[model samples]
Target: MITSAVRQALRTRGDEPAVLCLIGDLGPDRAELAALRLRGNDRRVDLDAHGMGRPVTVEGIGGEGEPSSVGLVVIAADGLTDLRRAVTVTTQLPPTAHLLVVVRHVPAHLGPLVPAPPTIDEWNDLHELRVRRFGNRGWACELCFPGGMSVAEALAAVVHGPRGRRRGPGVGVLGGLSGTQAALWRPGDVAARGVTATGPVEIDRVTPVSDLVLRLDDGGGLPFWEDVEVPAVDRLATDATVAPEVRSPEARLRVYGTDPVSRVAPVDERFVNPIGFTKKTKGPLGELVEVEGRVVVRDETCVRIRPTPDGTVTENDLERVRHLRGVRVGWPEHGDTATVRIVAALAAGGVPLIGDPAPMWAAGLGAPLAELIAGGAEDVLLDPLRREEHSIRLRRAALRTHGVRTRWRSLAAEAGLPVPPETRVSVVLCTRRPELVGFALAQIARQRHVRFEAVLALHGFSADLPEVDAAVAEFRATGIPLVVHEAEGEKVFGAVMNDAVDRASGTVIAKWDDDDWYGPEHLADLMLARAYSGADVVGISQNFTYLEELDLTVWRGYRSEVPSPAIVGSTILADRVVIEDVGGFRPRPRAIDSQFLLAVTRAGCRVYRTHGFGYLLRRAGGGHTWNVDLGYFLRNHTEQWIGWRPSVLLEGVPAPFGAQADRHIDHPGEHVERL
Candidate 1:
């Protein structure tokens, strides 16, 4: 498809200078093949495939030396990152240059080839590409090259011809599967089944005027033959046998999607609104939908319902519940698969589901999540505090069990793929308090499902201190690697952290706090979020805080699991390369976490905030670098507990060493100083 596009461009340009810029994961072998194919047609076409940072020379193809202007620029990109690189290269080219962008996997929603206005950096470039509206030209799909048309003909239609008429919103089904297994799926669902699926195709709304409509009868009572406009189906083709009466001979179907799993990534509740919606004034209840003889509540109120249709819930249904504060799920009679899928969708978004525990547990939901399921709608609907607490616990369960990555991992295992290797993490703990060293190391020791090393940076203290030596010895006995670094007393906090990081050897680095409480699966959960979200940095929100002086545990309902500008400093876990790319930790005495997050964001790197279920930040009187007062946490808290009540996800975590003594310390400032 790429070679044909190139050939057509050459035909139109004639003797004009042309350059082909290959970007992304297109391997050297594929690049060489593409170059060879282009050159084989004509010896005059001098093309060399270069990596993004390298310069491309259009020597003999354009002129004797480097040509000042090129008539045509072909950019073939593999993914979003490559597209950003293409955008950069386009800016350097002549304004009059005819641009052609070929993406291997075009997002289903992109309508045209015209790129959005470029941003100041690559991260913004990617964000723009994701959310920007597209026009009807400038991009072509390698997968959906129109059949029976020459490259020149297709290019003319795509670039110079009139814009294609926009189809109605909803799915335009072209073919039918055998027997009663016919399922009306969105583009993402089809893509997950290894078929090329495209669209913002709404399954609930399909029009007879749709170019390639399929007649679906799933044996359910719901109306399947209703004539409704399915707006904006760019193109879709399925391998299922075509229905003779509905098939259009001239109408070509093209489906596009990144992946089925990735389709849910945007809706992953963890990454949605991190701020708690509990404090907001309640709005009027919205429309309600009935399914399976039950009133499945659909409203703008605090408690929403995830309406399960007769069959599987469509992508549109998922979108409806995406921002919901809490979802009330009722038993769906639609088989086990549908039930599991519905729960997964709800849980994946970090939204708490209020339903009977028995059904959810039968469907394989384990503890904490099962515990979160309310006995009845009235249990949480009448109490905002109960709902908010449930949301926190549910978010934690989502990270550990219901995440998209976790689901895929389970599927992969069922298919008999080899288990993936555990991610290696270097825990960097920098602190001035010698008494809290053992307490912090104990938290690191409890971490599971990851290979970890401890890098203890004793800021303003010597390693020879008995407390420091004893903590190191105990941690090393756990068989995990330990590296101790002692920074001079005068060193800045950020400088001390960098020194410790320098001595660490792990693919990923996790910043640890000496005085904070962490769950056993904290690092593992961060790893899961990292793998699924593809963010440069991952961290938990500072949701749970223990006010030592007041003997109160405050649950600050901070938004989590979404891309944000910043996350709690100590909860940060980032790949070493990403940290290095952003120039490591800034050399500052205070607010280094915020500073580092800012630097990375400006560098076009993503910062993802995962759940705060496993981490509990400690706030004593003065002495801390964060320096926020006790009342600040109290003011923002959605709920408060009298004793030390962390999320159930932290159940397996051991109690902090010297917990009783540390609680009654006279010099709280000297006893708990985080470097």
Candidate 2:
């Protein structure tokens, strides 16, 4: 992937200089550099003289102003007649840019004054190998910074005794995570060794886009010079942390962590967790055998990880609980259980966690480790260390087992339909926006689960809705039955949908909103979830919406991994009898879906949630959203809705297409009806 990325970078650079070798004031032969410049785009600049510890002045040759920033910096060690000038130049480059240091031999002169990088094993031979690959037996050996370190750090690596915070706690954390490549601050000069260490260190800055910033000391202004190398799988937002507490089966376990009971669980009445958390919600794994299975799971019981009689701990224990959605476990009775050993090993490696109990507590496994995870006086007890540990090993295994990369074709097999497409399902699509009717119709035409008819209900008359009627006429060629309903006067959104449902002659009536988009397998997923989960009304309660003004795709409901009494809205597929039981949708200008779902729940209708199977609610500044507070709506603290990945209820289904932010749908292809 890295090689391909580098190649793509070269390709995209076009006519720009691909390799700029700075050889003192003149830099590597300008003529050679010019030829090295990647194809077509003619963009080049020069840095005549560079100061090692100081900044270098840049001259922009093109119309572009003195460059705001640059992407790469290359320095030749042999041309370094002045060490101070070299130090100044590298420090001035962007923190994010890549740096390359070319050398004929290891420059021992700069080692003591600057931080040393990881030792280069057989540096001469390695250079010879690369030089051969480039077919340029040039007398220079080049050193590229590993893992995209900041240019500042790369320059520091050229010098003497500890150039950074050599004594602080961050050193340890950085040491543990880097494995054998950790160049840390120890007594004199820490060498790259596999230091196994773990503890809770404080996070100085949660810079997700770049560095894993840490606070090395309790005093204000902790060392900013060093950073921890967070594994890609272990990285997570500051707010997202795991809180696990062990409890006796009879201990009356409420919601775990800082999650509110109302939001996470049905609260004896409601469902769904507050944002930034999860509650103990369980459902079938959806691993169907031969035929699809209709499974119902309301067991909110947290999986208990108890100590063995001998109080032994092992990797096997962690694996045992790996598949569980939520878990509760006490500290292993044996003082040196596998959990304790893992934490100790990580601490020994210099990777200390950041949280309430502090690094020392975890370093020693002092008292009960469960206390660390259960320390939620205000909110969730965020144990990032424990969560990351699982991701580093366990989650990757699960991902590898499912070798199939997600795509439309692979997803088709995953969508395993419980019943064939010939089974009729009615989609009551209500729309007030004539301009976007084509968009809605386009999605309807693309649904992979085909045994459905479209009941296109336009709120206004045909005279005012020329665009809608035009789309309708265009779709007439498609063989799929599309029953058009043109309301004569202004009608409420709920009334329009309810009237369509009344007129539709299918056993299943699916509610659909015009602005919302869906995956081709959406209806199929819903129908399967309803069939297998034994749900009276099944749909994606985890409503992922696209915020048009913000240009962001977001999920509103809290519990996205389990079932809850969520306002599933348009994606809901209700049995005709269930709709009648709820007395149909109450007609109002707004909050119609919410009102109807509430009625359904109150009337004893079973609402099952599905995963991200493409029920994208397109939220804009105008329209029905006027009824709610935008801030609260965006943050999603407003309500508790229960739902999980559609794959949980329905077996063998990949994620819905538009569920990912980048895979967002914006097309309304030819609306010609399929015959």
Q: Give the candidate number with the greatest TM-score.
A: 1
Deviation (Å) of 152 in candidate 1: 21
Task: For residues 1-675, write the lDDT of model 2, one tens digit per residue.
Answer: 212223444455323233343432222343444455443322232322321112333333223563333344454432222221344334434432344444322222111122344455512222211211111211222233222334444454442221221111111122112111111111112221121223222334752221221111111111123324432111111111111242223222322122121011000000001111232224222110111111111113432223221112122222223333323222322222223333322221112122244233122243333243334221111332223232222211211111111111122232231212345789888766566666667667767644888898777756245566556665666677889888745777778778888889888898877766566667875654454333567677544555656555554434432345674576778788888888888887777777877887787655666554356555677776235545645674322223222111122222221212113434322321222
Taken over the whole model, the C-alpha lDDT of each candidate is: 0.52, 0.39
TM-score list, all predictions: 0.56, 0.36
RMSD of 2: 25.4
Weakest 10 consecutive residues of candidate 1 by summed lDDT: 160-169
lDDT per residue as tens, model 1, 1-675: 554555666667546555565644443424553554444323221111211112344444334563444555565644332343233233223322354556444333223443322133422312111111223222453212111112222222232111112111112233211111222222112111111122222342443212222222222111233323322211122212224455543432222222332112112322222222332224332333345443354665432544323222322343345444455565544323334444554554445567655452233454555566644254454455455546555655654565433543443343334445556799999989888787788788888877899999888988777666766777787798989888899999989999999999998899998778788888987876675454678898788888888877888777665666668888998889888998889989998988999898888776777778777877877778887767788895778987667765665445343334234223224223232
User: CA shift at 575, candidate 1, in angstroms?
Assistant: 2.1
lDDT of 2 at 26: 24
How much is the lDDT of residue 539 in candidate 1? Answer: 92
